[model samples]
Target: MKYQYEFFLPQNPKPIDTITGDIYDCEKKADEIVAELGINEDDDLIIAVTEVGNND
Candidate 1:
C-alpha cells in the first residue's frame, strides 16, 4: 500500500503537501506530524489516504 497526506489551510489557495508515510504505516505518522505542526482541526484539516499498488 501507498500512503500519503494533504494538509489544507482555510485561507490558502492550495493544499500543502505534508509528510509521506513510511512503507508500513499512515495514520499514526500523520498524528505525529500534526502535533509537531501544532495545528488542530479548527486551524486546518489533515487528510490521509492510501492507494494499493502492485508488489513489483
Candidate 2:
C-alpha cells in the first residue's frame, strides 16, 4: 500500500517535509531521513493513507 508520511516539529502546525510511497520507502525511509536532520522526542510523524494508480 502507498502512504503519505509527514514529518513535523513540536508546536508546528504543518509538516517540515512529506514523503509519498510504500511502507518501506515512505515509513522506514522517513525514519532514517529524519534521524539525520535532527529532532526531539516531542516531534511527531503523521501517516496518511493514500491510493496510487487505478484500481480498475
Candidate 3:
C-alpha cells in the first residue's frame, strides 16, 4: 500500500516576530507610541523586554 504523509500544514495567518527591548509597562507604552507617532504599515517600532534563561 502506498500513501502520502505531510507533517507540516500551512497556516491561514502567518506569524511575524517583532523586536523588543527591556522596559516596563510594555503594552501601555506600545499603544501610547503607536498613537503618538501615528505609526502605520510603513513604520516599525521595536519593543523592549528582559530575557530569562531556562537555567535561572
Candidate 4:
C-alpha cells in the first residue's frame, strides 16, 4: 500500500471577489501563466493540482 499527497496554492486563502466568487491560481499568476504554458485560466483565476507518488 501507498499514500499520496499534493501541494496547491491559496493554502486555504480567501476569495478575491465574493460577488463573482473569483479563484486564484496556487502555482502561478493568471496573466503571467497562460494556456501556452500548458495551464488554463478557468474563470478569472488559475489553479493547479499535482500529486506525488509514495516511493517506499
Best by lDDT: 2
lDDT of 3 by residue, 1-56 (tens): 22221111124132222323333344555565567766642245543234533322
Which scores better on TM-score, 1 or 4?
A: 1
lDDT of 1 at 54: 41
After superposing candidate 1 on the true structure, give the runs of residues whose Cα lies further than 4 Å from its correct spot: 18-24, 41-43, 48-52
| Model 3 alpha-carbon drift over 4 Å, by segment | 1-24, 41-43, 51-56
TM-score of each: 0.42, 0.53, 0.37, 0.19
| CA error at residue 12 for candidate 4, angstroms | 17
- The most accurate candidate by TM-score is 2
- Show model 4 residue runs off by greater than 4 Å: 1-28, 35-38, 43-56
Residue-wise lDDT of candidate 1 within 5-25, one digit each (tens)? 565656776666555555445
Q: Would you give me the overall lDDT of model 4?
A: 0.35
lDDT of 4 by residue, 1-56 (tens): 22221222344454332211123333333445444445345643524333334435
TM-score of 4: 0.19
**Tens digits of per-residue lDDT for model 2, 12-42:** 7777777777667775656665687654433
**Residue pairs with backbone atoms closer than 3 Å in model 2 (clashes):** none
User: Which whole-number lDDT from 0 to 100 does residue 18 have in model 4?
Assistant: 20
- lDDT of each structure? 0.58, 0.61, 0.38, 0.35
